[model samples]
Target: MEEKKIVSIEDRIPKLKEARKKKANRRLLFYLSIFFLLIAAIIYLQSPLSNIKHIEVTGNKIISDEEIIQLSGLSPETNIWVINHKQLKQSIEKNPLIKEIKVKRKLPQSVQIQISEHKIVGYVKSELEYHPVLESGMIINKHNISNKGDGPLLINFDDEEYLKRMAKELGEIPDHIFNLISEISWEPTEKNKYKVVLYMNDGFIVHATLRNFASKMKTYPSIIAQLDEGEKGIVHMGVGTYFEKLEK
Candidate 1:
């Protein structure tokens, strides 16, 4: 029995073709894997599901989410990449009532908006409804009226700027001094010079004119310091700032 070795170009050619086919298949698989990975990374970065996936809001009272979204130009489909957050802030702050605002972005697609709303230091009485007076000297006739029962109520005048200035004074006077019975009247005594007449919530009267207002307000604590609770008389600050004490 003789062992025979077989050799033929036809047989070798088929083997060579099979090897080449296997190498080509492996390279194609490698290229496909790289392409799919690149696509996955891009989608992860740009997809709404992965970017800005959550939204939160805070510091909003009368302003609703819908109102904020409308004013901010933010929506469920807003693209986080191109959203100009600074511009959104400017638009939201356009409302006189909004004092401050802050926005933050989180990883994996989340956004949060924090807000600071204006406070009602006092109120302005309108025809049917009264609006909350902001500390910054703005009046809105739409907010629910709260009875701030006795610091100073401006009546018979429509001076928005003066009302805001007066509201700030309420914060200066101690609560105890404020409780001293009073109604504030905005009477246009002469021209642009608006004078304020104070009615003691009690029976005494305080004549307050709008001049160096904050300075005059500082005198109230010391001035009232001497007056008795029952000394019901008119304390005047209109001319040269003096109190006309009436005998009990």
Candidate 2:
């Protein structure tokens, strides 16, 4: 067997140096990668690519998209990362017509606004124009009677309190029954100040008091079902529920 050769510490020193250099190179590459990533992040945040480029509004009827966007307090200059959704929603909901709203950020650079408006129950006539009345008791003067369909017509009822009560009662009734009502005239009597007459689209008249209009009118379908199909007249639920057939 050949004699075993002894390796000097000087020979191992070169290998140790090469290993240290490799470790340092790896560490330097890691730190450089981290530094470049941080710089890229800063650039992405400050660039116009991070700004809001699109704003979309939906579920608006009376209010226009431009009007809603103006109310939202959001502009093209706004940064998508710093949007306060709650504050923006509150601002848009300040309009009486907007019952609810939602704001969301789409990926890249876009914002979406969803709105739910109050239900328009009827219209009140003033001169030749008709103002739309919402379920929240607000009257929108933007529309006229000609622009509207056959909704309730309020006669001699201008009191906001009374109108609110009327609107509340009308809202409680089912849509099927509510749609049948063509006109409503508030005619207060000495005995009952809340008395009103409803003219149905089916050519039948409804006499009811605002006190229990919703409760009483709920039985309207059953009452009409019991009557003859050929018969048409007045349905009186003002005091006790009864029917009066009009003789030809």
What would the per-residue lDDT of candidate 2 be over residues 1-248, giving only the tens digit for each residue?
89999999999999999999999999999999999999998998899989999999988877788888988898989999999988998888877778989888898999999998777788888889777788867788753222343357677777888889998888788888888888899888899889999988888999999998899999998999999878999999977989998999
Lowest lDDT sum, 10 consecutive residues, model 1, at 142-151
**What TM-score does model 1 achieve against the real structure?**
0.59
Candidate 1 regions exceeding 4 Å error are 1-41, 51-54, 58-66, 116-121, 133-138, 142-152, 159-183, 190-192, 199-204, 229-231, 238-248
Among these predictions, the greatest lDDT belongs to 2
TM-score for every candidate vs. truth?
0.59, 0.81
lDDT of each: 0.68, 0.85
* Residue lDDT tens for model 1, 27-105: 9999999999999978865777654556777877757766776688777677666668889899988777678999887
lDDT of model 1 at residue 191?
Answer: 59
Those runs of model 2 whose alpha carbons end farther than 4 Å from true positions after fitting are 1-30, 142-150
Q: Candidate 2 at 192: error in angstroms?
A: 1.2
